[model samples]
Target: MRRFASCSLILAGGLSIVACTPDQPAAARQPVFEDVSFRQDYSKKYSATDTTLALSHVATDRNGAVQILSSRGLLQPYAGEFLYPGTLVADKSFRPLRDKKIRAISTYRQQRVYLDDKAVFSNAWAGTLYKKHTLPNAKHFAGGKDFSFLVSDGKKLQYLNDGIAWEGSAPAGLIDIVYDARRNAFMLLSPSEISVFSATEHTVTTFYTGKGLTCLALTNNAREWVVGTHAGYFTLDAASGRQRGTLQRKLPCADLTAVEEINGKLWFGSVRGAFMIRPDGKCNYYACKRWLPSDTVIDLAPGADSSVLVLTDRGLGEICFKSMTLADKAAYFGQQVRRRHIRHGFNATLENLEAGNLGTGTLDDSDNDGLWTCMYLAAEVFRHTVTGADDALENCRESMDALERLYTINPMHGFPSRSFERRGYKYDSEPWRRAEDPEWDWKSTTSSDEAIGHMFVYGVMAELMRDEDLKKRAVVLMDSLMQHVLDNNMYLVDWDGKPTTWGKWNPEYVNARPAMVGDRKINSSNIISMLQTAYYFTHREVYKEKAFELMTRQGYYENLMRPMREITTAPASADDWSKMLSEAWNHSDDEMYFLGYWGLYRYAFNDTLQANFREAIIDHWQAERPEKDALWNIMTAVTGAQQFDLDEAVWYLQEYPLDLVSWKVKNSDRGDIMKIDTNFRNQHTAEVLPPDELEICRHNANRFGLDGGNGGATEYSAGDIWLLPYWLGRYLGVIGTPDVVKP
Candidate 1:
């Protein structure tokens, strides 16, 4: 049964609907499986064939020779007549078969058969010799079970039973026919109509009518028929001729050529490619050269082991739906993160290394490597908690070690560097200087974002890590970082012996701004959370004392409690910093605010304070839902707020394309998406571009933007965007663990 994440909070009434449910039931929620489809060309595999098969029509003969009718003439497995060879044949005048204008072919009782404008004939090698037979006035032929055959002569349909007794003509204007054993009847189809001729009733019944209906197939349940039209396909009730549902709105392409049901799945072949509709009505598309020999799918045939044989104009190919699952996809992408994106245990990189191999260079090119590494470490820690995997624990330890180096490598006590590198190695043009130790160098200009990330991970590690040494290490780092701020009057001192820009969280700087300024509330909320986290892990009274001092004396708590919707752009001030703060939304600040909330609501506040924090978090999340950010939604779920958009969070994760390469994606001229006007900062456009067409995206990219950078060149790691939210969802009990079936 399909199950979704549940919410307990009543969003409209602001009341708790129920107590939090136990984790076991939440863990048992079933995951909705979806198909990730890609296309490829296999035409090159058959380039050495003797004839250029156009694949206008394909059928397997009795001897298992896959024959294809091309513009060049009849081509099959063998060319010679008496001693038939396995080589491809193109001659129409071979042996007893001499029809150049053949329309269709079928296998009947181990006999190779063909139909032309005038007759139906067969040339079979029987009893060590070739035997031939021809029946006149046959235009087309369709074979059914038990050697039953339906023959058409341009205008009439006739059925021949297994005993070779001819059934009288029943209908005119018939274009194609197929037999359904379940109904014990023959289905006759025309360009715009379908009729069922039941043998028992000896009556013809019209089933459906639609313009340009091209193909028909019985559904897996044998209760309905999938009728394909030029625009799309729909389901029609077999017993009553009532329309079940039309799927034109759900299809990716409309110009369908053929439709077939194989193994309970409906495969629609079209001019653009093929679309497979599952029993559950989920659609998966295969059109590109990566999955198809050509975009023009002529026909489809069922193959062994639940696979489908695709006949395109270029060649034949097979699609195996069982080859991979969502678990396999997640594991493959996780491997990609480790192999291609990791830099010294950090799972996030600004650009992928060339050739799947690292060059002789330092991995500290990204200034925020420490922050990205901390986020990755938090993901691993959550993974370990959920799955109890020793490898995930080991990964967390390694990443934590790298994160520790960011603080220790710098000379200033308890101050973390933006990033560190080996001596004399430089690729980026960011500000850098040699450390006190001669062997390495570290970057400067660390911002508040790094601090918040450090504290967030520190809180999580202190709670989740089982090893005593790791726990102590986390507490020590928390103490040192918090003490640095306390000693330096709430500012992170840079290498130049001054407060770095964006590192000022002191009461003086925060209180000087108006309440309407975003930084005023953001700084107050972040500092309170940092102090709370420092106190929670270290059990230090000074941390709590400092937190309350700011809240009570500087109005920090009230500032943070202001409804997010009430905070808007403030009037410009004379000072440059104030003027900058008065501008419209800074999305980076949104990233920092949500990231800091992990500690703010989870570790800092008691039950009473947390209730108020939940209100603030919900308001912020309500404003952020328009962006459809998975990270923000997942983070909000940790607060246990009802109506947190859990479904949209999962949709974001599922809709995110598998391609993580940061190719340049431009969407300014796209005609398919809706465009709206916006006044928010950093939101360049209102178009919600498809994931595949957008630039290689990360969590921070605007989801509604029309343009992305990279020039089709660099690709970034999807670790932070994918792994973080996925594991967080698991840890928060929003995403259930999938059942593992060992091979």
Candidate 2:
């Protein structure tokens, strides 16, 4: 026997108190909030300690301690601790140092300072420090295994090898020099040219020429160099000096200041931030307050394996590329859902509250609150099924109760309002007013979208949840809603005793339209799935008989099998319904089709018609690939379609930005993207806007739209867009479960 919590009574509208017993099972109690602290801990554990000195240069010593050179002193991290300031020679202007033969060479006001593991040695230009008794009057230095080169006043280049000195002249307007040990040569850079000087051959040759050159680094093979210019970076062949293609995307900032090769990846630092270009050409950008202390990146250097040390004007930051995983990401987002996204018992479609706190505003009251809440409940149900967590089960129960209230709050039997509130609850606009019941308020004109969401969650609960009481409640809700449609001629009757605008799915309504109308196909597909799910959960033969009747007489199965390409807009018609239904392609229909497909493919059909359903699903999925929608791909995977891109699904999860607030994002001025022709049915451009530049998006939004804004009135929640795909991917075995220890 399951344990139940105590019941309570509450007064409504100053009437007599009424008994309100919330049937919460013992296993489904309130969840204790856990701090989402992984990212913070990872940031703290990997970042470098703060230093007060104004740092000018940074490099990694052989011992893996990052050496810091400031205007007045030197510092180095000691044995995984904070940077310890080292003693500075008085009145000396120190040039940046380079590691050579497990030693670092630092130049102090025309004097050479050689630092090894044990001690630091200062030698004047006239002193006998090595076989060569003279050091060049240089402001910059580059070192190799057996030679050290210096650029004096950025023009005269001199190299010391085996106590012998060789001299060369840099191109006019020289800026910096670096040694490529693999090629046994020194690369000199000016504002617009690169010159490679070979000390052995006593020759200097211009390697590449381009305008706005700022920084360069050789590849791991020493066969090509990555050149960072003010515009963007590209690769140049070291031997032929020929330009390769530009990177997959331009760096975040145009004023490139530093570039380095770290663990086979090219790290570029610019005035805006730092970015890493993998060998496969995928770019990962790091910037803003979460990833860096400041946006002005000074330099980038390699640290311990796979870690890159970032130098900014404020301080140093170290990031380990492999420290984070997908599970950690899921945990963080899950907490965001619980904290900022929940309003009352429902999930807010648009969260306008401050972080970690709920706000008092009209934004919390959304028309589709029940729908979003149901989707979130489905995600938690899947999570509970996968992990067997008590908290996830509790969350699902809470959302389920909220969804049920949408039906019971309205006086009309089995008619679910879009949303409901107390009589005094404030609403700013239309669709929300006092219901027929003077003590309550409800949103009217609820459409088919709400019906789809309610049925989807009801079916999932009946299948996955273990509680017997909840299962019985789901059955009752399904029977009530399905019977309402059946009794009312297959149309959802609204509170006004008439069919809602989009709730018509009867044969007379759907089959009267042309074959090219999307509504005809979508409505037929939805009603079949609804009847099939209703029968499967309720064990009612009426639902199964109705499903068969529709398939045989109404031709719903044939309607659904029509190829997606054939569903195009027809010519304008005289009738208003026909004109509206055949006007253009509706992405809302895509949402309805995929959501209904959960039941259409999963529970509706047996082995006989499975192949036909699979064909229809694949046809729709193939047409949607250009949008690269993760939700559609993961949903289609339930039908065992091998053509779906699993890697792209993971990329979508990872590339989704952390900012969940619905900020206005505009991209009309971007230069890197392409434009395409637009028609009434197809509005997608040639290329998708990069994820970072897009607004907080939902599955229903136009994926290829170039400009979007949320009106700043509400912030969208990521619960459906992110949590649905992630959990569905887990349920289908397409995404692996990480070793995440429960709190």
Candidate 3:
């Protein structure tokens, strides 16, 4: 998906600037692709404290309903609107099975069969006891064609047909039983080999032999059986019972514990997690609490819908796949933002979620409230520009009001506060300052990242929003903020008339660090962009003059144009501030740089500076390729680059987990990745983990971080984390409209 650049000629106040069109026609834009179908995971987690819910096996009943078995009894799937739990089978009116400890279960034609120590029962026969056998105990059961069935109790195996019990040459150490309709036989699995009991011949024969075998399942095509072992799994010839190939173990998880073929795909449950092998030979791994109640999977089964049921020791995980487009996902996240994340018109997090329950969440404040609101407001602005949606416009207006309040709530001249809260409720104590209203307090010591983010959105709103009121307000704020810096010697002076830490853009402060330090390049880049945006909107001579002086006289141009590769750890002789800043790559600065690129390139004083800024932006994006961040890639598309990793961008979007709860996810103990020694960028593995496989985080965090979360204590907002990149991609024509397709 590549497109030629489409430019909009803007003539404002006797100045001309050409910017990328956000609402260009599809005919002039090449589509990313015909919005194809992708898998979206939905999980249901159970508590770990309850022993009665310790499931061991899962299978569908005769009515195609899921039934899980444990030592206590059976349970069924319980569903709700968003998040839900499971239900006890006895509560669903299974009176005869209320208190019985089920050992095995099977589904026959129009009947659900269960077995205990000495009796077999059927739900379709209007009686609990369908037959009585002399078996001391039964643990595994399966049904063959007609009334044929088999039962095993780890040592003894027996066959039954039409109520006649026939003794067979039983194999010791029996582990499981499955019926092969293609062969009209019963397959008995042990630790080392498989045996087939031919119902017609009334004899047992060796089917296949293997070591460390645990479980097996017949394929939907009826041509092969997938056999699982402690190491991995392999396919078997259904007719000849011959092994297909060497055991294949290269997977997201080895140590296979159970296997099931559902919907023409092989699904596996390992000691670590569960995975489904798609038709492309790639697996979609489901691990961590995000996708399961526990990582230790016990069994797998086909559920009522096209979903798969993963039974773990803790509970059941039902993963349903839905066909959706990026536009559809944006709409879903839009609703999610409004429902739970909005706090006083600012896009905020829902914290203190008890056990990942959304109903128990409370809207919380953050230190980057202004930055978060800027990104969310920009998303709505792009959405409204693309579709003219009324709700998007209203969201933009409301969030913009909150942003405007950041400036007015504090008494400091043109200094925007980081966030505000009701009196005595300020979460953090260090940086809070009382407001004149006597009922509120606003955060002080706002950093350079917030400053750049505010300027970026103000510039975007001024150029793209259709409402004149918003446009004028954005211009006024842009000028006021820039004037504050210009009047304060290129620094954001706080109430104490001193430069705040990380808010120093003065030449003396920025150039004091070595060339390799990131602050040198980031500060130079941000200041120039801020100055350029102020000039572009206000048409003031002072903004242009100040920008020129910094670029030519102060050596800021060379600093900003430095190659991204040159940024490394500061020398040992450097001061503590510079060394600490260069200890690892500051990903937060990446956020600031990309946000500043909007103003850096779009509102450049001339095309020559814009061209150099394009190179800088692309260089930063190249360094960030391993992360495959959707927002960075999409923002780099603003430079009209042909190859911005569009495929990887789509992967990032599609693989993003729908549940944004900050659940504790551990991937450092995984066996699939090739861990490496720590480096400057903290690259943990050869390839970064997929979005759903890792803990949910914001764009500013390192994507390579292996393990992090708050243990289901918080839920992050999708407004800035997801919607902004999606809408920005749509605005720049890197992503196309949703295709009309069936789910």
**Quick one: best TM-score, which candidate?**
3
lDDT of 1 by residue, 208-273 (tens): 766787778888577888888777778888778799865664465677888888666788888867
> What digit string (tens of lDDT, one per residue) describes model 2 on residues 1-743?
01223423332222222111212212122121122223211121122344454555666644454555554445554322211111222213334333322233443333445533322344454444443323233445666544354444466666655543676666887766777777778788888899888756768998888788888888858988888887777888877889888643444465788898877778888776677765555456565433455667877877665577777766666665433455666776788788667776788854443321124323467767877887888888878887887888888878878878778777777877788777787563556657677777887777887788888888888877887777788878888999989988898888668998888888998888888788888888888878878877776767777777787777887898889999877656535677777677788788888888877776644444555677898899987877777889888877766657776666677767655544355455443445677766465557564454566677777777756655344556667878888887776666765565343
Candidate 2 has a TM-score of 0.71
Write model 3 residue lDDT over 285-344, tens digit each, in one string.
888777788878888877766878788888778888777877778888899999988888
TM-score (all chains, Cα) for each model: 0.65, 0.71, 0.93
What is the full ranking by TM-score, best candidate first? 3, 2, 1
Give the runs in model 3 whose Cα sits over 4 Å from its true position. 1-31, 46-49, 62-64, 79-81, 86-89, 99-101, 109-111, 125-132, 239-242, 739-743
Give candidate 2's whole-model lDDT. 0.67
Model number with the top lDDT = 3
CA lDDT scores, all candidates in order: 0.66, 0.67, 0.82
Candidate 2 pairs with clashing backbones: none
